[model samples]
Structure formats: structure tokens, C-alpha cells
Target chain A: MRAANERVRVAFQGERGAFSEEAAIKLLGEEIELVPRPTFEALFTSIDEGASDYILAPIENSLAGSVHRTYDLLLERTLHIIAETIIPIAHHLIGCPQASFDDVRVVESHPVALAQCERFFAAHPHIKRVVAEDTAGSVRRVIERGDPAYAAIAGERAARVYGGRILREHLEDHHENYTRFVLLSSEPRVVADGDKLSLVVRLKHRPGALYYALEPFARRAINLLKIESRPVAGQPWQYRFYLDLQAKMGDPELDAALAQLRERADEVRFLGCYRSAQRTEKERF
Target chain B: MRAANERVRVAFQGERGAFSEEAAIKLLGEEIELVPRPTFEALFTSIDEGASDYILAPIENSLAGSVHRTYDLLLERTLHIIAETIIPIAHHLIGCPQASFDDVRVVESHPVALAQCERFFAAHPHIKRVVAEDTAGSVRRVIERGDPAYAAIAGERAARVYGGRILREHLEDHHENYTRFVLLSSEPRVVADGDKLSLVVRLKHRPGALYYALEPFARRAINLLKIESRPVAGQPWQYRFYLDLQAKMGDPELDAALAQLRERADEVRFLGCYRSAQRTEKERF
Candidate 1:
């Protein structure tokens, strides 16, 4: 286990104000030096080459569901998960200084953001909605274009970063929308309080194979937060299952259960036990 | 079941020349009047309100996973799947008249399109990739901005529709990239020689629930084309499974298997059985 004052460098995919960056800061804090990587592969490469101490990546979102690429990257990379955080997604509708409601003919944002703001757009039938790559990137586009007719649905922080005014806040249809992020570090941290264990296991593609693979956790009464599956590369009709168990890896019961699971599973990889973020109560302003 | 050549109005979510438009046209043909809906929910509401005869929505793509909202909408609405079509996605890099690769600093398009052209972007690291709501929408932005540095990755048809120049064609990383769209009509369609079945089922959130849910198809030797699971609304830890079966619903064996599956499932809904698109070799050019 690494010491706290080691000046851990964390890498995240996206620009400065991306939601992923928010997750990284929340997990590692201001003390850690942050590194930005353009792609998920680059994030992993940074960790592998010691360019970054850790990589913070999104695993799943409550509304959008699992990010399959992140799961595939986990399987492909040798990095270990040392922590986890769940960030609430509060999408806001923002516009540049040159734009007003009357002048705004089109709204630009990520598809997920657009989908989230469907209800909001329903009222403004005249305005065309456009999806952008990243929330911050959309804000930048609105700034660069300087078009009064163009607005973006992005994060509140993104609006501030890109000098965009907030047209509307909390534009997502669902209030409980949250994205879960996992921190991948080169060195595993010692399991502590609030730690949640994550594991990736490949089971035989046969009846009751999953049942046998999960029996160990069930026997230990270990609560699971989530379970997602992604197809194994180069293998047809086969999948590798990713599981999140709400127990520290250092726990005696969990350790024994994992050993048993390893024996039953065709292949089992420990993705490290990380501290889970405390569920936040919805804030009313 | 609706007879062929009957006048039917269909709603699609997108502007003209959008892939969804192509899918809608292919399914309903020139006989049906296509109503363009700005939002996906409006497409469903149009059918529910009897404003349109049917709706065409995308279910999944080979590269991008399932369109989850569509799945949730299917569960929320009473629309029936009357047909299905698979469209090969050929992304083209397009730009405004004055834009050139050397002058371009930013490339904009849908996230899926941006993801598909990852290798292309990697080679041109100087160009920043931006995402938008739609490929055509991105082209519109480039033209609206009139910036030579702005390029869009869109469909060839979109380039023609938006009057943008095709800077580079066939930019997708994978040649086999395809998107499967589902046609939801007010009434079901009779099974034909090439008909395929689509089913939605909910299983008890037990360890072997998924295995049991898949048993019927496996037992009948039905080729499972796609299987996706979305969280059941208001039910924590529960999932609703969406599947596409290669066998026609009219087949006695498949009918019997579906009946058996319904008995075992918590809730079973037959979306519809419709003709699968004929597989053709993809054009390299």
C-alpha cells in the first residue's frame, strides 16, 4: 500500500471541466496532481508508463447504464482499482453571451445530455437540438462560434469554464441521475473503512455457471452494488462479468470467498478494493 | 395484422437524410407519410395519440451498444414492433466549402461517429474532436459558423443534404459497423419467410434468473442475434431483458418456446415478429 503523501498523479479522459475531471478531484482531492488524457487507452498507457499515478474512469451511470468501453479497457489493462466514487450528474442548459432565447434556433450538447433534457426541449419546439462530444466541448463550441442561436446543455462548472451563461439548471429529466467512477492505480491500496471490492470473473458459458461463480459471495452474505457483462474480445458467445461487492478485500470472509470463487471461475481477476463514496442526499437550493 | 400497401403514417426522430430517416423510409416506403419528430418520445406519443400510423426507432448498433432510452420507452409505451432493418453505417468526414484538413483545428459530429473515427483522429492529433447531437446537425454547425477549422464526420447523404464538401469518406474504424433499427407500428405484422421475432421479458432477480430466461431459445436452437438488459423501473436490482430471436414467431416450435418462456418469466411481452433484412456484402468503396 502506498502512503498518503506520495503526491499521487491522477489521469482522466476529457478536458478541464469534464464530469470525469470532477470525479477525479472528488476522489483524489486538490493535493493530487491531475493529468488529462484524450482517450481511455491513453489514460491506461499513462498509468502503465508511470506518466500518471492513477486513472479515474467512469464505469456506469444510473440513467445511461454501463460504459462498455471502460469495462473492456479494464479487462485489457493490467491496472488495479484502488478507489471508487459516485458523482451526481446535474446537467444545465448554457448559452454564449451572443445568444438569447429569441435568437437561439439550435441547442448543442452530448446525446446523453440531449436525451436527459428532452422534456425541457419539448416546450421550445422551435429550437433544434444538437448533440456534441463533451459537455465542456459544447460550451467551447458555443464560445468559438459566438452564435446567439446556439446553446449547450452541459455541466454547471463547464459553463463557468467556457464563459457561457446558464440558460437553465438541472435540465435532466431524472433528479437521481448519478455516474459511478472507478480509480485505477498502479499500486493497490490497503483495504480500509468504506471500502468496496470489485472483481472481474470469466465463467464457463454453461447453465448455472454464473450461479456457481457467485455462490462464494452469497455464502458470505456480501452485498453486491452492481454486476455488468461485456463480450470477451476474440471470443464468440462468451462474456466476462464485472462485479462490485460492498465489502473490503481485507475482510477475512471476503478473502476466503474470493479464493473459493477463483477455484470455480475459469479466470478471476481482483480489481482491488476501493473506498465507496457516501450517497449524497439531494440538495435543494 | 395490417395488410401491405395500406396507407400508414410513421414518425421518425431526426431531420431529413438522418440514418433514422433512411430506416423509416426503408420500412414504410413511399406509401406511408413520414412525420419527423424532434424527440424520440414524441414519436411514441404521436402513435399513442393516433397522430401517426407507426414509429421507427433505433434499437442497437454493432459499434455502439443499445439505445437504452428506446428500451425504456418500449416498456413505458404500448407500441408493437412490426418490422426491423439493419443499416450499414458509413461515416464520411465533411467540412464547409473553405475548410481544409490543414486549416481544421476541430472536428465535430455525434459521439458514436467520433468514436468510430478514433484512428483517423489519432493520426491527426492536432485536430480536436467535438461531438454534436447528429452528424447532419454537426455539418449545419460548421456551415453556420463558416469556420475553415471546423469539420464534421457525417453520412455521405448528409454531406449532400447540407451542401458540405466530403473531405474524406469511409472514416469508421470498423468496416462492419451497422445499426439495427426497429419499426413500431400500431398493429403487428404477419410473419413471412424471412421474419424474425423480438421479445421482452422480466426475470426474478435471482442468481440463475438470466440462465433460465435464455433456456427456451437455447433449447429450441434459436439463433440469438442480440440480448440487452435494462433496469426495471422502480424496482431496484431487477432487470427487463430485450432479445431478438432469428426464428419467426409463426413457427410452432418458436411459439411453443415463447409460451414456455412467458410462463417462467415475471412479465413477458412479444414486441413483434418481422422480416429480417437480407444480409449483403458491404461495399468497400
Candidate 2:
């Protein structure tokens, strides 16, 4: 799908108006072609099959911890992280052309979206809350049904794409809600000045193992952006820790710390060292 | 609601025929009466407000990593665990009168229930999957709609409660899928012979921090049943680890290990030491 190496084709999971798509365009700009996949595996397969040059997926959300499937997929696939971006989420309540507050009976959207808009729904308890596969998919359903009683809670972009009217905007309870997306490619890219390193480490199932695992970062005074753990399969009570540190793998100090971490850890994998995107101004509620 | 100290009133988050209600019954038996709450917070609030003696909540599933909100709520509330039980999930495809496989166009259930029945829906792609607040709630929606084309995937108990017929049984993709429920009470209960201890530990950001965290169990050869992590609010990159160990807190070795773990960890909190339910053979798929 790429005409040249400069124009990378990125694959993401979800429909056209998905926040993931918004993240992809924000990070890569509007020049690159975006391909949508139904599932996370399909996104990785697209990269592995050479159908796309890169894949952009949400790693974590400020409100909803880590996207476990994305982490598991990252561990399963051999793709390299090339960049990262944080997208501010501004959820909106949308409805069909003939729908109004009085006509609406059911509101549909993803569980996460519905949860973020808890305050809005709490104010109007009469409307039935329904969870759909995707936010845009819900919009599509409302359009297809042509039922005035059906509405969805999604992004403003989704409302425009599906030709739905915005019944209410900025419905999320929190203003700091944001989702972090990681860009992965088949080949690695050079880490620029403002790059971040991501690593996954499997430690020995012993006392003080994780303490020793984090010693390197602590000793180096490195700023850790995030740290999470997932169950290590086949091992009854062990876990593999994933961390994001504010230093590139190429940095001498970071390289040294990683080397020390590797010596103490049972297994260590360098997920990637990628340039981090600058945080955009917070969207006002 | 308590007539005597021996009897306790437990609040569960679900309707009358929910699996959660069944879990509450199994945990407390006929001696304790169940107070059903529509939401998880209500269950916790019932305990906090001194309206209930204890609360039984589903913490995790074998297939799902963790019921995250439960973890967050556990951290937010000061409730202590007094007992725990494991429940095997058995999902059933149910529909109202006049609705058959051919006529069904939409299937509704709780998000978790819908996820468990992914394989069934994949085989019948024409049927749209919808997510309701709960399994029994989905059945209630079908009954309220009185639409033959609208079906629901719920538990057999829910089907009977809502006067629906089973279109298909044992719809979960994984035959061995089970959910782990924790019993929370106002005060800690005495640990008996067959008891398990649960703890929440926060480790300092350093290398081998987690390894050191679990050293107590590893040194004494005490079995750890489960370990999961949740982020600490206001502290980016820091986490609080939740662990379930096989031995009770009263055990000399367990006590020593916890002491050492507390010394090494940034913070340590003992949720409770409670009797673990007997493991029953899973029902036939």
C-alpha cells in the first residue's frame, strides 16, 4: 500500500470515526493512508503480511488503565515501536435526525464511553444505556434503524461522519481524560532528541525481585511514565512487568541501566525506543 | 438487619437471578440474607452506611484479567475481606416466544457475558451483539420489547426468571472459565485451617522491587494464588499490587514473610485472611 518508504500505510483497529484513527492522523499527519481492521490481531497481521507499513494502537487510557490485549499483542508480535501520541478524549452525546430528548429512549456507545459520561446520564436517568461494539458502529446503527428514539454517545467526528446531530457535548466526567497511542512498524526508527523507551521485564519469582528490577531506573533518577504488570501464562503466580521510561535506549545512562536490569531479571525485552509526541493543549469542557 | 452477631446481611451487585446472587448464597448459605444492589458502588455503600453486614463482589475471572472497577473500589473503600469463592460461568443463549434462530436479528447481554459467548456469535454473524447492564437485565429488555427477533445471551437462571426459553446452552468459548468472588465485611474474620490471605502492597520505584515484594512467599515456599496491579492515583508510574496467598495471616511463616515484605515495600496493607471455598469440579460443557 506504500508508494515509497516516506508514505507509511498505518493500520488500526475500529471504524473510520474511531478515536484511534484520530490519534493516527494526529501523530502521522493527514498524508499517510490509514487502514481499519476489525480486531487487534488483524492489525498485527496486516503489518506481518506486509499489507501495511505500520500499526497504531492504544496502549493505555488515563481513565481505563492499560489496554491488556494491545500489551499481549505487542509481546506476541515482533513489531518495533516507532513513535507515540496522547489524544485528549472529548466524548459527546449524539442522536439521529428525527431524534430529540423527548423521543430518545435508548442511548448506545462503548462501555468505556458510557462510563466516562456517567455524570450526564446520572442527570437523565430515564434514557436507557446500551453498549455497542464501537462508538462509530453505534452511530451507524442509529442511522440504519432511522429510529428517532435511538442515540449514541461518541466523538463529534463520529457524529459528523454518520450524519447524526449532537444532542450533548463534552459529556465525560473528567477533564484530564486522555488515551495514549503507540505506533509500531516492522522496522525500527532512530530515536530523536525527545524519545521514550519502553521495556518489558520478567523477574524471578522471589522476594525483592521487582525491587532489584527497578533499582537501575531509581539509581539513574530516570522518570518513569508508566508501569504495569500482566500475568505470565503457564506460571501460576508470576508476572511480567511493563515500564515506560523517559529516556531513549541509545542514551548511555539508559543503556547502562537496562544492562543492569537484564543481569537481575530472568528475561528482558526492549519493546522499543521511540520519539514521544508533544502534548497538545487540553481540550476545554 | 442483623438479629445476632452470628448472622450477617450481605449485599450483592445484581438482580435476583444473577450469578452474583448465586455466589452470595454459596458464600453465606441460608443463614445470611442477600440484599441486591443495582450497582457495585451500592454494594459497597450498603456496607459503608452500616445497612449490611458484609458484601460479596466478583473480583476477577479466569479469562478476564480483573474486574478493574472492583479493584479501584476495593482501594477506595475500607472494607475487609472475610471469605472468598470461585464460581464457574455457564452462559446460555435465550430468547422470548416467537423468537428462533432464524428470526433472531439482535442478541443482548452484559459485556462480559457477550464476550464469553464470542464464538457463538461468530458462527451466527447475522445476529447483532448488544450489551445490556446485566444478563438478567438483557432478558428483561427482551420481555419488555416483546420482539421475536430480539434475543439475549444470559445464564439459565436468568432465562427461567424472565420466562424465556433456552435457544442454546453453555455458550462460553472457554469451557473452564471461572470467576473469583471476594467476601468483604466490616470487620476481619478469624482465619481457619483452609484459609487464604489477601494483601495490597505498594513498592518503591526501584529495580527488583516486585521480586523483593514476593520474597516472603518464595522464601517460605508459601503458594501465591493470585497477583494483580492497579495504578495509584495522583502518583503517575507508581502502582499498588494486590496478591492472594494460600496461607492464612496467622501462620508463623506467613506472618514473618509479611513483616519482611512490609519492611522492604513502600507500603503494605493486609486486606484480610479468610477461608477459601472448596474447589468443585466444573460442570460439563
Q: Which candidate is the best by TM-score?
A: 2
Fnat, model by model in order, equals 0.07, 0.13
Per-residue lDDT of model 1, residues A215-284, tens digit only: 6776667765566766553342356778877786567998898889888888998888766664332232
Q: For residues B165-256, what per-residue lDDT tens digits would candidate 1 score against the true structure?
A: 88888998878676778888667667666467778887765544555666677766776665676765333234677877778656898878
Question: Candidate 2, TM-score vs. the true structure?
Answer: 0.81
Task: Give lDDT: candidate 1, residue B13.
Answer: 75
How high a TM-score does candidate 1 get?
A: 0.76
Q: What is the DockQ of each candidate?
A: 0.18, 0.24
lDDT of 2 by residue, B105-191 (tens): 998888778867768878988988776778877887887788889888877777887798787789997776667788887776676
The interface RMSD values of the models, given in order, are: 4.8, 4.5
Model 2 has a DockQ score of 0.24
- Candidate 1: pairs in clash: A99-A148, A109-A132, A130-B133, A131-B132, A131-B133, A132-B131, A132-B132, A133-B131
